[model samples]
Target chain A: MNIEMIRAAQARLEGHARRTPLLNSPFLDEIAGRRVWVKPECLQHTGSFKFRGGWSAVSGLDPEARARGVIAFSSGNHAQGVALAASRHGVRSIIVMPSDAPQSKIDNTRALGAEVVLFDRAKDDRNAICARLSEEHGLTLIVPYDNPLVIAGQGTCGLEIAEQASAEGITKADVLVCCGGGGFTAGVALALEADAPCLRARPVEPEDFDDMARSLASGVIERNSRLSGSLCDAIITPQPGNLTFPIVSRLAGPGLVVTEDEALHAMAHAFSRLKLVAEPGGAVALAAALFHADEIEGEDVIVTISGGNVDADVFRMALDKFGG
Target chain B: MNIEMIRAAQARLEGHARRTPLLNSPFLDEIAGRRVWVKPECLQHTGSFKFRGGWSAVSGLDPEARARGVIAFSSGNHAQGVALAASRHGVRSIIVMPSDAPQSKIDNTRALGAEVVLFDRAKDDRNAICARLSEEHGLTLIVPYDNPLVIAGQGTCGLEIAEQASAEGITKADVLVCCGGGGFTAGVALALEADAPCLRARPVEPEDFDDMARSLASGVIERNSRLSGSLCDAIITPQPGNLTFPIVSRLAGPGLVVTEDEALHAMAHAFSRLKLVAEPGGAVALAAALFHADEIEGEDVIVTISGGNVDADVFRMALDKFGG
Candidate 1:
């Protein structure tokens, strides 16, 4: 996918999805020691940026294929995204989500009129489950981050960031994107590289699940051995996507990682100052902006808060511990 | 306050504050039985609509008056707002706050560079304190609301709502405004009356603290007997402001009131669906939108989320009780 494809995705998404706002806080700027523009994709459909890719993929499907429905495997955000997108297209959807996923995610996905097939997180293979289910149901499998159209779809967010930044007269800047399978980060980077060459993308992740960061540094695809317990569960991909890695490697800088505590602090700050609900995973990039301020390359920065679907318990804990 | 004064306030606040987005969600709309556009003043500077009024009041002051600084008496959002507004103008601020106010609010106000004077909530009269301080130190006392400039400043939010609704091709609408001293509601109503006569403002309040509702009905300033114990501490004004009551009574509908539980549910819904952090007081209008949907008189509606200075424990309880 190139600039044209990304622009096509942006046009396709125009009326279908929201153009989430770029938020700014003078107080937050004081904290980060720089001017920061926050893109709240938490306000996106399905409460995450995954909705962009899901909608893009679903909407791009042929009439017959769309009528037959689609299938995807994700523990939370992606599942809800695909389910909502398919429902919007008047298509049936079957989502293979982990049984251990938050009850809210499962319930919300099901509420969107999708059939939820919950597999055991510890034992069942989600990929295998999705494959067998898709084949049996004759459904198109919507890979979360590995498709060209989906990559282009996610690229629209980057397009907005670049457009918004440029509109704000920010020419030389860096965007800190929270990374999962490198889909969002790669797409954003490619769009920025193509459209606004002055802006750069910096991938951010939680400490242990920093495969994208390591991969960017090592100039190769690096993998995380364990991802079962990271606080930033939304962006805990084992490794960067095959389609996304190349674009990310070429267009983005070395990844930035923040600790669990820093992410919690970022979430708290978002709650008290920005007045936005930022899930811990969604706030990693914010953590990078606030805590790793010195490491970021530019004066003007964009921090992508990618999702807001935190468990009530975890959110309460963050508020209690890091509030004030 | 008239449209011209409100426009002047808007012009004065152009480069200083945020024009917070008017958020919409299909899910929230479904719950309300109509298309509901949420104006989250939660995103305003100092995390509430008070900043608009504060900035308006402070900026409207003469150069010499601004140089001498200002004094305000409040426990939470308004204090912080005045402090922040004063700080922005390079003016010194002295806030007389109750000792029982949340530590977070007090800390945030101080952090914004205000000198905080803590008085006992039960024993001390904040009005007397402010009066004495203003007279003794020659400081201009910035009333939280009631003032014409502050009301005009807050009217900018109403103008934005009307303009946004018109932009979306909505001509007839009901705007649910959370009511405390009626300043915001009256200002918004007056603005809507002048600019977008097709739109109407509806004042919403907590169940027992329905002074605005009763006052609107009786054409008198009805006061709440108990003020300090309501969960919505931010908007627990004893009665509608002397200056603001007449406008609100004449312009708004019979005020809508919601139960505490409904307000808490609104807060939880805001956290999960709108991905906005709304304090209980802020969520009152949302409660009216969600729980009192039938009473709201238009297909196109606007819900004002007034503030987001909730205590961590209160927010946690809301999330736990009503969060998905």
Candidate 2:
């Protein structure tokens, strides 16, 4: 919500989080026709920047509240992030995921010391299920994007980008961030506003899941007609969070969107040039930076590769399509 | 090469080389049954630690010699490393490679501002070709692993490891390095000997191309029977370097070798757990650390992913074989 709160989250995250490298390649620079600096958050703990928000929210909880445990409703990156954070914090984490979720996701969550509670997405309301579970266990719901602490935690990435950019003598650039429910976008925009005033944050999304882009264009909250089917499943929320939308609207640059193919292509480039694995959602910002260069301004551009918790087959498909 | 020379290279490489991150995963730790820290040199410039040695050798040249440029004979990581290094230093680079080498490799070297001279592997002597090119162009030969300054450059990676390990409170551990002609292994060993004496460097190689290992066991330089068939082609040198062998033998712990299958399996794990794109040659040290855990003597192990220049098909095959 604020720079102080984000700084506080960064204090909690010290040593616990990996201050991932700002990766670049001449190949990428040539392709984009500009200086491309990549913040590979895929290399972060839990293979995603989600770990930052997870740790922030969990660690920010009061001692008594923290002792009761926490719950998250996700079958993807957030589940693993919260699971690991809670385990590291020595508290039980209950993850509510659809039974239809990939077995790897279920297994990975459990492996991170979380109690996996599966629900039928088609027949059961996940929110209702989470509410009941939270009530029964006296657990705090670790909202994925809507919470203040979570936004502050995600803001830590923005803080890193600001410092790293300054170190590279980059004072001004458009920072493309892959957006799900706008927590990362809003957090980064706030941090950049406070720390690196000239570096602007822009939300990037998949073509069909461009609710943030649409919302920014319309100057109001917008919703996606459909989700779930995108290759960028890690960031396919139906709508931007109310808490995050206001902040993004106020401080962020216009949102950008890339097609699924573009995201996969960016994933391949990330693999071949940056030597980093990036999930489709994680690669959307990079996709925008590489393919949508005309829409962006400035000589230098920064992009956040948010996660790499991708399935092997999907990653192979990406490489096959784009030739790593 | 001693630590002072390494420190000098570090000074010359202060802003040019990437200080790649030390990445880890609980999943990898569980598999290794010990804490595993991966120094991902694959994320270094030109997607390998070779850049360190390349820059060291090129930058250490006298003004007249540097202006005359540099030449190297490699179809893989070294070619790219030296090419990029020379280009950045505003000097011409000539790379002599086998005509049968992958076209991608040839094209990539050229794209990095290097002049590529192809020769027949069966009939042409690459060393003679390089010698001719060097004389014709008044170019200093940038030996891949044998030069003192090259070793000093690679030693900078060791310096980083010692500092990072100390920051993590790791005083003692085996630092597994993917070894070819022993340049990287020797450099790291010399640096660790001075900085973190408790951290011992060990050379890792592919099964058949284990010249470094055999040389260490015999307490003398030894040669491989053949070098072209290994999947880890980047490290398929015929023999250990004369300059590197003595330092490695004196300062290094021992040598480790892993099978092609093990390297591929480790590559899969790196992609899955660490979100790193590690080629088979690069993954050998990680393979040794994970599958050869019993052979190692420590609760913590540090492995370097030497390079990530594998073809897309090869990376997919690795994933298919091991399930990333």
Candidate 3:
């Protein structure tokens, strides 16, 4: 919520997190008609920036609570990130996921040393399962994006962007962030406000799932009717988090929305030009930066590729449709 | 080349060359049965480490000579490297490539601000064309890996590895390099010899194109009988360079070789786990570290993914066969 808390999270994540580099390609700049720099958090541990938040929240727990173990609910990137964080801290983790989730996600979460509990999306109540498990095992639940410590952890990436941008003599630019529950956008907005005020944070989402954009425009929280079926499945939260909405509304710029095709195009460009793998959800910010250039203001823009955990078939589909 | 020249190249390349991170995956470690660190130079400028050597050679020329421009003969990575380097230096570049080379490579080279002159690989003499063009334009011909300055430029990667390894508290390990004309291996070997002496450089090549391994064992230069039919075409050189062979022979460990299948497998792993796009030739060192684990020594190993410029079909083929 504040710069000090984020800096405190940075202290906990000093050596634990990978300080991913800010990468750029002349070809991407040409396409965008402006300078384009990408912060590839896809290269972060567990192939996503979620690892930052996972570690931050896990490590921030009291010694007794950490010893009691942790629990989380995520069918994708968050599952893997929290699992690995808990495993590394020598703490047990119980992940509650929908049985309909990708098998690879289930396998990868378990491979990272978590005990995965699957529920039916149409039948079983996920929250009840998590509640029972947490109550029985005395496990602390690591919320995906609504927690303050988690936001602080995600803010570390913003600090890195500020420092890297300064080194590149980039004092002013729109910092596009992939938005879900808005923890990442809120965190980045807070960091940039305190450290690099000229670099404003902007949220980007898929076309149909533009709750953040609607909420920003209406000055009130908005909700999406559907969350599934989008190519950018990883960031399809129904609405922005209560804790995050206020921060983002105060400090961030107007949100932007991009199509699934634009996300695929951005993924292909990331693979071909930046040599980085980017899932559709992680690529929305990059999509906005490259395709929605007219909506953006500035000679240069910084965007985040938040994660890279796409299935092989989906990845091939992206490359096939977009030409890597 | 000695350490001083490499240090000087490091100075010149301080901001120009990307200091790619040494990335690792717990999954890769599980497969290798040891700690494995990968330096993904595939993320470097021009999608290869070739950019380092290109810039070093071009920038090392006298101001007057550089003003006259430069020329080079390459069918793939080298052409793009030199073209980008020359273009960045505000000098002209003429790249001589075989007409049979991949169309994407030709287009990419020209896109990087180079004049492309294609010759028939079967009948036309590429050297004759290069010589004539060099004489006519007063352009200095930049050799790919044989020049001392080029080697020095590549050595800067070794220096970075030395520092990164020391940071990780690794005093000893085999540093694997994907070998072609041996310039990269030789440069890294010389760098390790002076800085991280306990870390040994080892050359890795495709099974059919194991000229560096053969030359190291025989204590003389050896040539491959056929050069055109390998999955790792980017590294199928005829023989080790006259300048590079001696340095590698004196400083590096016995060489290693992996099959085309193994390279494809490594590429898949890089795509899935490391979020990196590695071409077949570039993945050879990683292949050696992973599938050829028994042939290597120690608890830790460092490997380089040299480039990422595979065609979409080839990449799809690798993914289809290896299951990215």
Candidates in order: C-alpha RMSD to true structure: 2.5, 1.0, 1.0
In the range A282-321, model 1's lDDT, one tens digit per residue, is 9999999999988987777899999998877788878988
The better candidate by DockQ, 2 or 3, is 2
The sequence of per-residue lDDT tens digits that candidate 2 reaches over residues B53-116 is 9999999999999999999999899999999999999999999988998999999999999999
lDDT value, residue A75 of candidate 1: 79
Model 2 chain A weakest lDDT span, ten residues long: A315-324
Provide the lDDT at A87 for model 1.
Answer: 89
DockQ rank order: 2, 3, 1
Lowest-sum lDDT 10-residue window in model 1 chain B: B17-26
Local error of candidate 1 at residue A182 (angstroms)? 0.8
TM-score of chain A of 3: 0.99
DockQ of 1: 0.64
Q: Write the per-residue lDDT of candidate 1 for residues B1-324, one digit (tens) a residue.
A: 677989999999997777887788777888989998899999888889999999999999999988989999988888988999999999989999889777877888999889999998789887898888888877899887789988988898998988888878888988899989988998899899988999999899998999999998888889998886789878889899998998987888789989999999999989988888999999999999998887878788899999998877789889878985
Error of 2 at B80 (Å): 0.9
